[model samples]
Target: MNWPTAAGSDSRPDPDSEYWDERQETRPPGERRDEIIEKIGEQVRYAYDNSEFYREFYSDVDVDPRNITSFEEFEQLPILSSDDIKQEQKEHPPFGRFLCIDEEDIARIYGTSGTTGRPKVFGIGQDDWDRIGEWHAQILWSVGLRPDDRVIITSPFIQYLGSWGALAGVDHLGCTTFPFGAGMEGQTEQAVEWIADLQPDALYGTPSYALYLGETAEERGHDPAEDFDFKVMFFSGEPGASVPSTRRQIETMFDCEVVDQGSMAEMTPWMSNSGCRHLENGMHVWNDIVYTELLDPDTEESLEYGAEGVPTYTHLERTSQPMIRYWSGDITTWERHDETDCECGRTYPTLPKGIYGRADDMLVIRGKNIFPSQIEDQLHALDDYGDEFRIVVEREGALDSLQLVVEVADDAETGPDEFHDLVRQEIKSEVGVTPDVTVVKQGELDRTQFKADRVKDKRELAIDV
Candidate 1:
């Protein structure tokens, strides 16, 4: 089957309306399901027909993509992992067998951040890129960005797709955009100065960078809340935007709303699984474009609402490089469409708490499972907590040691001894782990203009030895 054309722009929703596409966003569950199932069937058939990877992978398991009709049948298909992508790319090079469109038709190429090893490459066709742009425009509109609003995008223009998608959405919505990318020598200070000078209405970047930007503004002797004109801040690449403590901190610092949203880089329209301006505590999974299934990590069984599971995703619209049942390693609790009470009227399933951190990032110390976010939530609750902190886990002989290197706010009034005891007591009482708390003065800890890697597992060094 030939790849389909982009959804017509003539039917695009009115920019000034309350909902981006009221019909699509607020459709009843049964109606949406029927539409989604049909699309899934088409996508599976197309992938089997056009992509060699899908044909081989499915055929090996005796699963025919053509026969897959329901979610139940689709679940029988093997889950795709990052390792699978890495191996395929290594064998096939560049786009691998996943590239369905002709090489000349490839419009854009992006990849993973490559923090660990070689990044996984993704090829996108012009039609797919157009759809991604439209999806994001709908997403950004859900968060109340008007056509006339001025937006400052702080994401670095690398292989990363988050910022690029945001810029596309901004353009589609007719908003004035300043692509002030981040991660340079003095970009933070310069970006702060630009914000002060221009007073842009909206900003997009990682949640950690937004907090760091507030600190940078303070260093420049400017109060962020008073000096900036940001009405809303959209964040991704981390969970801080949805974390209660971190979210409140940014909101109080900038006097604006914090909208937390993100998606896997392989799954291009990063904002497809995002929160609207009116949705609190969680984000809506826009299933029309991307279908997400929460499954038990161990058993691979589909999880019901209120259960914690890994978000396995399938692309319904992507034609160039489609991912079916791709595993997202992050952990989060979700609610069914009818279970959530979103005032925005969206019927999509809600992630009551945004992604809790990667499953691999969870630390098993002293037989107690600990998430860095649990510690972050604890620290940000403290009145004297600074903007930066790091969690270090090391092996001490046979037992594991968890040490928290935290920073005290510059204007903190509490004594180091008293504050240290308070931090230790809080974590022990709340998180069920007694940690060795090392307190440093503010600005002593390293900062990032992107996703902050707060955890350092030194236990690996011991293993290597």
Candidate 2:
């Protein structure tokens, strides 16, 4: 569906309005489907005419872009992966052929670290930038941010839009954007003092970073819930705010509600789904600007609404550069509302659980499908494990084994045997794999400034599967 255009810079929505996009957001699913089909045809025709890369790609695949009329037909369009874009950038050099806007029209450029290989850079034109701001503005609003609120962002701004994209939305929404970049020495300590001093209305960062900073503050005589004033805490980049125990712990420590925002790097970096602001835990998908589907990772077949699968998003209004069926790699599920399902009263598709985990991060050991997020949730359910953990997988006598080494936070006074049984039971219940649980002392796992990697596979590979 076509995203409603942003109002002029001088024009903004009413601060007290129930919704940012009142028209499109509350429409019934059947009503929007017709409009979505019309917009899909228009976007496809525009991309075929303006993008050199799409012209050749569609032709190579014997697909006529103009022939696509419905979302079902549009989904037949070829899917693109991160590696595919990297290769195109390598062959084209700098900005790839998919960039539809002229070089002079480019307003800003952001990119990924490209740890796998070549970096992927995306250009943002003036119009695209404005629309992106609108997308994120609505995201913040859905997560309980207000126009009069001030937010302190803790992600780096250089060569990254994860933080900058959100800050831009804050500007458009008339909020004071606090620049507090993390991933540096003592940044957490500095954030602690700033939160206590300024007492901002809202705080933003990854779940781990925010919780770590808040805990470090408590360790140094400052209680976040008492000293700091935070009405809401918005988080992205990782899973935790959505986990019940972790969410409860953070909300109690900060004395505020925790909201989860979902986004991907290749996408505009924000506004994939926004949390409900009116005391709701579901995440609402921005189906107006983007079309998405959930598919089984291995079979690449679309799944039912409630089944867990990989997400693939196609940008509808992205004019500077168009992304067609980009595999998001994040595992999630969604269900359309049956009228008043959300307390927010918006009809946007809701993700009851924000994110399960990454599809690529799944561990298939001994024919059992396990996800680290599931295990993390188990750890969160109990207090024996600390904030840090690691999963060690190894092969023994032609059989795979899992060893869950969890850090002892020292707060729980349970014995080792009881702790092991508790963790084993939790994992067996959640991940469906009964494994050996080892309770290690605190500080056994090194903590990073960003999302912590917890999985370690030490199994020797065989010549054949």
Candidate 3:
């Protein structure tokens, strides 16, 4: 099918097309907060009246959703986490009452990756699916995806949200989509060969998988940039896409703009860090469908714009499986920039910096706190280390310990012992912890085709020992 193309170019839509444009343009800074609070109240009342889960959960709170209008009262409601959703599903079985509609009404079923526990089953009605597709289309446009572009997606389609949502975006954009599902078995090589032939204009996957493809392309003597006219490389499922070192590595290898896309299966497509221009700032949230708030992680108290805190999101569009005051577990600082204009002239509130890291991912070792991303940033700084790595967590005595396992680059001749010492010193300097560093041969550790599972909890091993 011939895709729809704009009259002049393949760039993103005019800023007016952004969901937040009208609200941001018309409403003054002071008024926008009140409007958002009112919208939240309306959404709460609608969900409580219509959704079984919210109705039951809020029954004990004993307050009219309308009266509980301001952000102050909104914070009074108990925070809902992934664990809460999982427990509810466990008690309800199959599709949870979190769903507003009956099973017959569900058009699609998608689940979380279940890396932590049982995958949370989320149902999407036809309208919800369409909304998701539209949001993804906006994200694609934000990152320079055009109707004439051909895209290859490397995320898994196995009941996961990333691949399906991204595919929907390509379809919505009227671009040709090649679903090269994850897994580095024989299929990955074949997918690379196909991309070499088709020469898709864009590619999407986690940073690790994208790097793997680049390495594979090099082995086959095929330069992806030269062979395929790729303009954008979209990445998600990990923070590597936003990290400077990682982004530079991918762009240098693939010869394209590496754009970071962020969302959860529960939230679907909420925001994309890729602006109309290539500045890798914070993600532009879809204010029409989702409302976001930052709260002090410890106290759960809401923080004003530009303050760094944990991110909590409320779905404004979700009706099938409504999530209100859902704690995303990601920590970030947000600001509504009304005066500062981006190069693209989009007036939507910008994140300036994408998600920092999950509050849960923080590890306290030797009285020092550290995040896996910090370790990742430090490791990526090393000249001879491969992009693939993992941070294993274990309990030693009464304290938690961290170990760094990284793959050496192909050209690096440094021995594992020397490399380990270098990594150990780097961690001590950066994170203030002397983590055990182990350098493995190139491709020694299993390379993930989807989200890279870096942390392996070895508390059981510590107990056994």
My TM-score estimates for the predictions, one after another, are 0.97, 0.93, 0.88
Two-way TM-score contest, 1 vs 2, winner: 1
Per-residue lDDT tens digits for candidate 3, residues 303-396, read: 8877888767787666578788888898666766553345554545666556657887777777887877778878878888866788888886
Summarize candidate 1's per-residue lDDT along 1-465 as a digit string, tens digits: 233546436344566688877888888988999888878888888898999999899976655688677877888889999999999999999878998889999989888877788789989988888888778888989999988899999989888889888998888777899999999999999999999999999999999999889999998999999999899999889889888998999999999999999878888787878888887777889888788899998998999889998999999877899999999998988998678777788889999888877889889988888888888988999999977899999888788888999899878989898889999999998768799999999999989999898888997766443
Every candidate's lDDT: 0.87, 0.77, 0.73
Report backbone clashes per prediction: 0, 0, 0
Best by lDDT: 1
Instruction: Give the 10-residue window scoring lowest on summed lDDT in candidate 2.
Output: 1-10
TM accuracy, model 1: 0.97
Whose lDDT is higher: candidate 1's or candidate 2's? 1
Residue 369 error, candidate 1, Å: 1.4
- Output the lDDT of residue 188, model 3: 74
TM-score of 3: 0.88
